[model samples]
Target: MSTSSSSFPSSASSPPSSSSSSPSSVWLVAYMKLKFFTRIRRFLRSKAPHKRNRAASDHHAAEKPRIIDAVVDDDEEEKKDTDKSMVLQKSVKRLHFGTWEEKEMAAEQIQRLARDDVSAKKLIAELGVIPVLVSMVAADESGRRRAAIKALLELANGTYTNKALIVDAGLYTKLPKNIEEIDESTRQEFAELISSLCSLANTQSCPSSYEIISFLISILESKKSSIETKEVSLGALYKLSIVLENAGALISNGVVQTLLMLSLEKQLSEKALAILGHLVVTLMGKKAMEENQMVPERLIEIFTWEEKSKCQELSVYILMILAHQSSTQRAKMARAGIVPVLVKVSLLGSPLAQKRATKLLQWFKDERQAKMGPHSGPQTGRISIGSPCNPREAEEGKKMMKNLVKQSLYKNLEMITQRAASPSSSNLKSFAISTSSKSLPY
Candidate 1:
């Protein structure tokens, strides 16, 4: 009834045995345990290697996308998507037809898009939007014209290749014509658009400039044009001069007389002076000629007309412009009787006219310089206004100054004259015609 005390051996260190502790049996048991464990280890290792490789492959695949796809995605679809965003949404979405505010916002957005130096350019190319913008400029609404002008200004900046296109589109002619019937605000918007276009046209140095100039001149000649339109027209003429200084366009356009007439208008005198001053300096060779250009005669004729019209500012400005011309031109101008008119201008004009007359007298003095050459002969003095008097000769000076001041050319001339005769007259030495040969510094 006794049981044998047997214990199961631990796997870590025990040897396998078939019978009781026999060496062979122990060896065999150990070998069997070893073989079983080796088989199990091989099975686990095989499966482990496959799992480890699969995991590594998956991890590498995920990590590989981060590097390779980064550049490829950027170079492919994503790049195109970035460009497509710039394409102007040409279809009139619901926003285009929304409430007044919404419509305004839409127009503003389009303008902002067109005004953006980068986006406008891309959108213009992508959406073919120039026609749309021209239509906007032609719109009856002032807000629309303002927005369209901004857009067109951006589009037209430094782009001369489109000048013919713009003109051919009849944008300029139509805008000015329509501006006449519009409200004042709308007219101003049109003016702004014209000014911007002029700025662009002035900078264009190509041969085709004459065409634009011609169009502007036509607009200027429109007798039905409003004063605002005329202002824009004259401004455009000034810009046209910048383009045509050497192009011989202004002379051919016969604009000098138009400018001369404009100068005579009391209301338009300032603007006319601005245009003539630039023309005097820029279009010197193009002055009226007996053969090719008769600009000198045309200009002198304006003085004659001014003298008749009693426009002293006009006379002074005309004289100033003549004074800047060549010696021959000045002599012709003087011979045309511009000098006496200016001398009268200096004497009769108010302080403003007198100041300009002072400069005109200075130009006359330079004209005398050109006349003082050794080969020059003693020319007959200008006697149209009575005997010319010299400095320091009191009685004769009194007579001549009287003749000069008697014209009373300006609206404010009487005020200036009274101011000159006041007890404080000594402070007004500039108004005095001194008898010294150098009495007039000019």
Candidate 2:
């Protein structure tokens, strides 16, 4: 085939007798070879376009899905002509009654199918496969547990129903007893899955028991745990803290101190402070936080964080709750030198944080004024703690005070008279003299 290069392929020089020498003919030949690829660019396709995302949702049509993936997918319909049954049925049965190897295989398959197949996810849960897979998570074999966890993670994605199912199956109680016992990879997988499921808390009655809290705390405290794992654990705990009822469980498990310690870490501080913000609202949470030695000072340290504005916001929020109606706690915060920090945050922090800091500053100011009333003033007289002599009696004390005042008045009048004029200016100089009548009654 000869060629030309004017706004066409070099092969366009070939005469218009059907030949594979041009770009257009090349695609046409490939389309002839394939089966269902009838349309040119897979758009405005009359019957079926390219099945771009074969998941539950399809954007080709309106919000209503064009054709179901599991029931009648493009790929399966062409290949499995005789076996028209859905793979979901076979997979559920095998997962339920299959042996060890079969169950693992079934989990892997379910994870794959349920990944993008939202329809298959609901179907798999409807077939009662979730509880079985959850049981597999507790299996002694590491591979079995990992497979089940991965499958459950897939099933829980964007589906509240599957998450509730996993929780109902006691997944909270199924966590590994010790984070150290499991390898790092499995621990991370567990954390990720738990973090996903923890979203179902508070809005519904998902049992966010202490077991889950302790498991997450273990992951957080683990030295071997990755930053990502700790972050996931922190997120789970934060979700659990949303419900006021879970405060006791979280507090009893000592999440307060751990969170207080972690909130100082700049990277992890924001999420950790968020959880503490939720907990600090409750009475018990307030008490627990107040008792921690790191409360106001450590939290005050967060305000100095000019970069992490969110952390500064949450830290100030917790401090406001701590100093709300409690006078003693405010005293402690005042002593911790939170006044300067709050002023800085009120000036520079986020708007919400600024408001909270302003409120706290007002409270501190009010309490300080109340404790020392308008008439109650600072000490002008020097009173030393190591002084051996005692204060004089009331009458003698009054006399001494009067004498001191009179002497001070005399000194002032004498200085004024001297600065008035020289003795040569007789009239004006004499008029400025400190006469006896100039000293008023003490």
Best model number under TM-score = 2
Compared with the true structure, what per-residue lDDT tens digits does model 1 show for residues 102-204? Answer: 4445556655555654534533433334555565666666776666566666666555544434555557545544324555555545555556566555444
Clashing pairs in 2: none
Candidate 2, which segments miss by more than 4 Å at Cα? 1-90, 203-205, 375-442
Worst 10 residues of 1 by lDDT: 1-10
**Model 2, 1-442: lDDT tens per residue?**
0111121222223223345388787666444423212111121122232343454444455545445544356556433421212344345546854578888988888898888567657766866778888888878899999999999999999989888888888887888887799988899999899889888777664866778888999888888988888888898888888887889999999999999888877879999998987787677887899899887899888889888888887787677666666788888988889877776676666666666676677676666546644442223465566655555644555666765665565455344333332333212111111231122111
**lDDT of the structure predicted as candidate 2:** 0.70
| Model 2 weakest 10-residue run by lDDT | 1-10
Error of 1 at 288 (Å): 1.9
All candidates: TM-score: 0.43, 0.66
